[model samples]
Target chain A: MTDATPSALSPLAIDVRGARYVYPTGNVTALGGVDLQVKPGEIIGIIGQNGSGKTTLTKLLNGLLKPTAGTVIVDGVDTAKKSVQEMAPHVGYVFQNPNHQLFARTVQMELEFGPRNIGLSEEEIAVRVAEAVEFFGLQDYIEEHPYRVSFPIRKLVGIASIVAMRPPILILDEPSTGQDHNTTHVINGLMRRLRDQGTTVVCVSHDMPLLADVVERVIVMKSTEIIADASPREVFADKTLMARTNLQAPQVTEIALQTVVPLGGPVALTPAELAADIAMRTGRPAAARTDAVG
Target chain B: MSMQAALPVAMIPGNSIIHRINPIAKLVWVVGYVVLAFSTQNIVVLYSMALFALLLAPIAGITKPLLKGALILVPVGSSLLALQIIAPAVERPWTPVGEIGPLTLYGDGIYYGFVLLGRIVASLLLALVMVMTTHPSDLFTSLSKLKVPYTLNFMLAMTLQLIPVFQREVGIIMSAQKSRGMKGKGFSAVLPSFVPVFVGAIERVQQLSISLESRGFGSNGIKTSYRQVRGRPSDWVIGIVGALALGGLSAYSIWRGTWNISSDIVFSPLFVVVTFVISATLFFGVVLFAVFLSLKK
Candidate 1:
């Protein structure tokens, strides 16, 4: 839902009102008048082509980049009035490049860095570090240097490092970039788990299938503005919107739209849904159908 | 691509004696080499030192980078040598090998050129051995152990890590510029592309600062390190011995009134022999320790 119409009962986790960002150096407008809102625990995916202001938008939420116009209220605190360091406890950001965020010598230290920075007690820091290490499957390399790890593992360490901070809202920029299928699957599972635990997850990604599978809402951006914000199913169903944004629906969704639509069957966002739609149209027994698709 | 391939002299993982030697020990060795290079100008002594440093490369598992650095330095060293030999800064009583315009090449200048080449080769090899064996973190940890300021240590580590990143960005910027029909060659041509590259670097730095702050970099609490640098008894022994040897050489040079004896003092053959023996022993001792540790392990 747009930030302008959030109900009073459930306060918005992220509220942006006519938020606009311009690069100071070139006077280039990156975000041209954006308005959006994210409810607490909502898993939202932001998708756009290069230079569509997806990253710049995420930076605004964390106070890394201030909005040139309007306001960004994260967890009821106006981001413009707070320094990035002050907003860190509320909005944890995981940068795309693990190298840029990773400065500690070891994985354990990296995970503890954020928690310790927020002035958590030693006991609390230990609990967070243990949880992150276990969740990210980093037990084996806890003592090893972060840079010595593989690229996929490094990205996981970067995510886990932010996760350990226990910020109510987590923002991941390009989490699936350069990841293999299994790694992306693992990341998707992690994001879902975080959402289930009542942490709001805002992920910016180029992977349509991943966004469709994990995020409940998908926001399509084009030319520095949000063009569509709807449930993944509704967003993927809009052919004109997808074309204008230079995005493609997930393969399964595309197939369902192409083949299943002719048969008057419902659209599927995932392969499993497509399979089930096909089975139902063919009159297969529900018990005989596989439960593999999401 | 592997990270090692991207770096100039990537640390090769191994249990070799050289790797086991404390980073502080390696640092001390580097300091000693610098001191020795500056203390004496005898061609025989300097050449022996360079030869000895090069000889340690294989034992440390860094011969590849060592050879690469040496090959690159050859042309540089030759040019310096040629300059010195062709135009001696000051005339000497030695015989002139050749004359060009108003300048005469002297035998002393040739000897001095060899000494200069030895300094270059020895310094390069010594620094190469240290970096090729030790992790950047370990090096910084050693610096911290020496009581270097934390901020300085952090800056050093970041600088080392950013080298390859900056190189990659430069390549990306050049390609982007070329695709836009921008044409140039060398420094003048590439100068315009630096603006975008610099802008990218500034952005990266801002991101890095935020990342650091989120992790409590400037917090008021005592920060603990997960990777502790352990200085063993062997490290202390090497560090102390290397320090003493370097100190003794400095003292002896000062005592003999030959601390800066480049052209004026008569070349003392005895002092040259003594310097060779001491420096060789010290250098060989480090190599032997690496061998001993590797075999023991």
Candidate 2:
């Protein structure tokens, strides 16, 4: 598919268009005529205040809910037309609660649950379970009741539950919620790991700083529609978009934007990126990482 | 406590004698104990048994919060006591305030109500001890140990596991509703919260279950486990206690006059009320434990 063609025919992870939803009881529309496209192997962050249709949109992506109007395509398959089981091998969804999806009596049962569902043989299930358990560092709690352990460990079980399926795209809704610093770091590390494996990561979270660190592009939703979709640095750079969508720039980004006056000009939103640029102007530091953001 | 709230974690780490015992064992023990308690109108034996059961609270590591869960039955427990004491005769019953209509039928109604009420308390306290001491996972293992189908065991495990998830989702949906001006006047306001929580939970279940299916939950194959349950010495001790408790009850009941001329209450408002309250407590306890563990950070 060409760049000009519709995302449905292409290799995009998520392709949504004109999606509108009004609940059976409510007059207000939860989602109204939304359109978006996210490419494969990309990390996209969804940021919005409460009631901005973030969760609703994710539900559409996973086929958990059918749209009142429009269609959502994940990996070119129409989500609305298929059941979650049919769409599951390509797209994995993690709910906010780690406990809900956990069905096994023990942690090992939790991980094996997904692969077995997707028609993998016994040997294949075993291999995937072993690899995922080791990868997520869930070796110790594999024998305990998931509910008997710490909160982060349960969250890990939830993630491992999804990861065992080995989907091409992973959608984490509010993953950082209720997580501590160490847990967040572990999640951050997991995201990088997933990215290296070429799985598209779509995360919905209110943690602006954390999302900024992991996500390349962010879609800011406000009141049932897309308000801003841009690179994290570029989107955070725009003050007008931030105010309109009720998305606050990271404290550090705001600090840099207000304090730095490089070449007697206003500062950039992502100071870390701008800092390296400034240093490059003077003399590029050999130690600085210069990965591109799109 | 609110219906939707989950209990805190490790408040009951699920490692007690009562917890290790089988649920069937526990259930049978309570039934048997009540029969023993009523073998005679011997208040001494009944009170002593109550005291013994109370001792189990400590041995089972049941918390003050858990005992507080029992406070839910104070009204029913007290009312049942009052009814047993004040009732005229099983052959012909009458109420003090004839117009009030609160006093129930004559015949076997009050007698059965009293017996059932006592049984409920005894059974519930036993259940509480089991839950406080045993992890739901262990309970599941015990079920599988008893040769229950994997399907039934899986459903039970899913229900146990998803309890906290639904509970927290209640909070999330409540907040989301509040933020969206979903506060309706009177009972409708509850519907807004219910809709979100209900719809959210159902949605999550669908999503998660689908994810679970992909993981091979129902296949006819031996699956691996993250946790192991063994028949330790503690389990044997629990088995002994559970067995002896019921056996003694059966013996005592046979010797009692009341056991033969049986008439148990089938339904009462208070009985319904009592059940509603107890089930609610158990539900909250499960969910709360889940939330506490999930949100530990």
Candidate 3:
């Protein structure tokens, strides 16, 4: 996947050709020449240590940031030639900090703000807001000020606001941040639903368990460059790369690598896969219940 | 440029004579500079005052950033010059010197414009030096030592520190709004951004208040600083001398009417030489910045 390049007419959701970004203030190089391509409806997880340019790369797709040196083609359009607002119809960005975006009088209004801003009809805005409310369990806080809600709920409002707009490419920056197990599951389910609906999902996260379950491909970055771009099983199987990048695979995958992989069993990305692999290696029947129950 | 860098006033860390000087001494110098700057319209003296601050930049190890920071003043200074050139504030008998697209240039207005620009440059550079060299905590401590209420001093210092933090926050908020399909232009679009900024600020202030209270910020106790700064004998000497010199110069300028430079003086060879020196210094500073950037790349 690291060497994979998109053909000019391949209908890519995102195409980056040698993108480089240097912060103007400190002249700090956040991204040192990156090239990437994402297909439509694919769920891509970007994993990296802090300051490794995962967020910077995603910002380029939505036109929030223009590459300092190379071209970024999103949905067959040059991002450099379009303003962020103009690109918003094609790409929806959920920021890391929810406080930066939540300012409406109510959560319902907050969810409707984006769709309305993009010129959706009032009826369509209400319908989208209702759908987001149900999807994210935001119905309870529909009439409350977004800031007046719990932090987790506020984060949901922030994400739902962007999701309401229903852009083709959705970028989530640390979606599971500050979320509990139940809310994390809700986000995981949402990503899967969006992917099934053919919305290209690009997620930047440190939540390995969620990524292992939700993402089809994981791109490992270190020091502003992609080190590995592969399937979740392939990426999690490499212990040396994970250690060098200061990252760890999902706990279940790690356990499988340590206990089952040496026994010639395949890598597991979830508790069920790990259990089945362990059962196969030991020639014992797997547990009847492996639903990852609390 | 990043929004924070666009704001020209900030602290730059360095170990130099200017950085080591007591904040009280530097504060006194600022006070004196402000008083002297406003007291005169003499372009030479004003430009010299600006030059003094620029000359100290290398010594302070802030030559690069300071020069880059001064780029903010170029547009302002040019606008002032252009505005005065087109609309002279001189009394009755206007001496029209040239024409700029049907706008008559008045000799008195041109001279006055330079004088005003000189004043602005001097004040701005001095403020930049004060900010770029002396850390906010040091200034807070100095104020505390001067019997200023500790609460007031703390607020002032915190305000200085938070300026950059809020600048970064505003940038993030603008980007977030833009990503949400908000119009990227017009004043109406900007007005919507303020709501989020204010809400974020309020939440931060709440957290800060809680953190402060947890650390006994409200207790009526004598606070001690971890970073001790004491006024040296040399500091007192420089402060006293600088203040007295500014006072003497202010009186001399007023009594001798030295600020009333006639048209003959503006055309003098020496005045041209002085103007050329000022322009050359600024030009070199900009050129040096460009070279430094290219070398860094």
* Local error of candidate 3 at residue B121 (angstroms): 2.3
- Considering every candidate listed, which one attains the maximal lDDT? 3
Q: Pick the TM-score winner.
A: 3
Off by over 4 Å in 2: A1-10, A261-294, B1-297
lDDT for residue B115 in candidate 2, whole number 0-100: 57
Task: Tell me how far the alpha carbon of residue A233 in candidate 3 is from the true structure, in angstroms, after superposition.
Answer: 2.1
Ranking by TM-score: 3, 1, 2
Estimate the TM-score of every prediction. Answer: 0.50, 0.48, 0.84
Among these predictions, the greatest DockQ belongs to 3
lDDT of 2 by residue, A178-222 (tens): 999778878987987887787889999999878877888999999
DockQ of each: 0.02, 0.03, 0.45
For model 3 chain B, give the 10-residue run with minimal summed lDDT.
Answer: B268-277
lDDT of 1 by residue, A1-294 (tens): 111222342378999999999876447899999999998889999999988989889888887678999999987778898766567777888867665555456889778767776677999889989999998899999999877898899899989988887878889888999998778888999999988888899999999999989999998899999999999999998999889888999998999899997788766887777777877878884444343423
Q: What is the lDDT of residue B273 in candidate 1?
A: 34
* Sliding window of 10 residues with minimal summed lDDT for model 2 chain B: B176-185
Better of 1 and 3 by lDDT: 3
